[model samples]
Target: MLIKFDVTNEEGDRLKMQYGQKVASKAFKMAALDAFDLYHKNQELHEVIDSQRTEIRRLRNIIEQARSSAAQLLEKTGQGDLIDG
Candidate 1:
């Protein structure tokens, strides 16, 4: 996920004074780069999570189908009451 970092003019001036111009600028650059890296990592993690969810859903569907087939077979053999369906 993308994150926004904004600083107003007064904030910028304060930061510049607290830390010299070079240090302040370097800090800002590093922070921005770190944010970008975090966003990229977050995106990759989300993709993996989504893929896992899809796989889980697919597996659930297969399980439901198997249960349904089993129930049908049991019914044909006059053992339908054996299932808790």
Candidate 2:
């Protein structure tokens, strides 16, 4: 009996496993579990990246508001609008 298994790694390279005489089901199951773990870790990384992006955007908005308010306060106080000074 001959069995051919198609497996691919992170680099998208196809890995071929041949079972000529006997195959262990446990080994195959372990490989599948490892692949699942890799997928789960990738998902977690994507979530972290999304959270950081949201935080960056929130901080940028706050900075913009602070700059605008500072300009308005300077104008109201007749501080000569020293934007660069």
Scored by TM-score, the top model is 1
Question: Global CA lDDT of candidate 2, please?
Answer: 0.67
Number of the top lDDT candidate: 1
Q: Which stretches of candidate 1 lie over 4 Å from their true place?
A: 1-29
Task: Report the Cα lDDT for candidate 1.
Answer: 0.78
Note the Cα lDDT for every prediction shown.
0.78, 0.67
Clashing pairs in 1: none
* lDDT tens digits by residue: candidate 2, 1-85: 4545564442122211422213444445545667889899999999999999999999999999998998889889888548758
Worst 10 residues of 1 by lDDT: 18-27
lDDT of 1 by residue, 1-85 (tens): 5445587867766666754664556556555667888899999999999999999999999999998999889989998788766
- Residue 5 of model 1 has an lDDT of 52
